[model samples]
Target: MTDDADESSTSLLPEPLRTVTPLTGSHRDESMDVIGWGIFLGLVVLLLPLLPFILIVWLISKVTESLTPS
Candidate 1:
């Protein structure tokens, strides 16, 4: 039997979740390492200062959550 999906059924997916988009990668010598590290370091720089604050808030919330009767 042929394995083929219905085109109308595929259209039910949201735009971002759809696989119909074309592969338009950059036409340059851009290594994936450069892109990966750029995103990783960018997030670190943005979130480093907030990490301690987030941890403290999370700890407090977890403690409160545990103390509350189930």
Candidate 2:
């Protein structure tokens, strides 16, 4: 009949999935955003050029393997 009863029923849920508090802006999240973007961009810069060579090598391997007798 009350919100307490509703909450008691929801206790069956996992603790992490339960809404314990309202979301708030976190400095740690903001710092992580900066670091995440840096790592993402670093990976992009490092891998973008390698992608073509990787694909070419992969294609060549597949072609050679297919051409070779089983």
Candidate 3:
């Protein structure tokens, strides 16, 4: 008996997950980097200052509601 193996068999995973794409183009790399930095800076600039005020107001509301007679 002769043993034979087929090379056409594929796993259940998607092709993109199994393959690696190269990012050698400068424009693609720069665009991706800029987008990532923009998201990071946007969150820091916009949300960082408001977070503390939001927490303080939430805590004050909770305390006031608890202290007030129902």
Candidate 4:
């Protein structure tokens, strides 16, 4: 009964892995910076066409508000 209790209290991990060091950095690759910028620029390029549409909608709303009675 005591042996069963002792076994249950013991750790499941191996002895070497019982202690672990804290992480200080992700060690990301330098080339990844270019990829990140590329993705950001690609999103900007995709959204550029929508910018004109958004401006048109905003202008139409302003014109409608000005024409409405107070």
Candidate 5:
């Protein structure tokens, strides 16, 4: 059937995402900026998820410390 032929032809086609250019020259400088931002962003993202847990733990310790008589 023509449907089978079309499927086969489409399967043989290369994906369009293979045309990536390597970083070089000023592009390399821009890439380093991007990498720096990426790392910073990753750290912020990681911290955000832990922030609430950290705050809760701090609050619990403070409350317990106040309640405990010396």
Candidate 6:
């Protein structure tokens, strides 16, 4: 009975994880950087068409902020 209880208790505990692989490479780092920059530039490019709208909104917000009392 004691052995069964101990076995059950041990079974209830979580198992330890196996070893994990680490990343190490200049080419990988460069590719990742390129991907990151591409994503960033893509976002900027996508937002390019909305730049004027963003500027207008910003100007309106600033004007409102200036006109409103604190």
Q: What is the lDDT of candidate 5?
A: 0.89
Q: Cα RMSD for candidate 3?
A: 9.8
Q: Model 3, range 1-70, lDDT digits (tens) per residue? A: 1232233343354565544866565446788889999999999999999999999999999999999999
Candidate 4 — number of clashing residue pairs?
0
Query: How well does model 3 score by local distance difference test?
Result: 0.80
Q: Which pairs of residues collide in candidate 1?
A: none
Q: 1-70 in candidate 1: lDDT tens per residue?
A: 1234566555666666656878888686568779998999999999999999999999999999999999
Put down candidate 5 lDDT per residue, 1-70, tens digits, no spaces: 9999889988866767755787566435787899999999999998999999999999999999999998
Candidate 3 Cα deviation (angstroms), residue 47: 1.4
Clashes of each: 0, 0, 0, 0, 0, 0
Model 6 alpha-carbon drift over 4 Å, by segment? 1-28
* lDDT values, one for every candidate: 0.85, 0.90, 0.80, 0.91, 0.89, 0.91
Model 6, 1-70: lDDT tens digits are: 9999889987866798766888667556788889999999999999999999999999999999999999
Which segments of candidate 1 are over 4 A away from where they belong? Answer: 1-30
lDDT of 4 by residue, 1-70 (tens): 9999899889486666543867678687879999999999999999999999999999999999999999
Q: Give a tens-digit lDDT track for model 2, residues 1-70.
A: 7999988988775566657888888546788899999999999999999999999999999999999998
Worst 10 residues of 2 by lDDT: 11-20
Residues forming the 10-long window of minimal summed lDDT in candidate 3:
1-10
Ranking by TM-score: 4, 2, 6, 5, 1, 3
In order of appearance, the predictions have TM-scores of 0.49, 0.55, 0.40, 0.56, 0.49, 0.50
Specify the highest-TM-score model's number.
Answer: 4
Model 2: lDDT to the true structure: 0.90
Which residues of candidate 3, in runs, are more than 4 Å off?
Answer: 1-37
Model 1 Cα shift for residue 21 (angstroms): 25
Q: Name the lDDT value of residue 33 in candidate 6.
A: 89
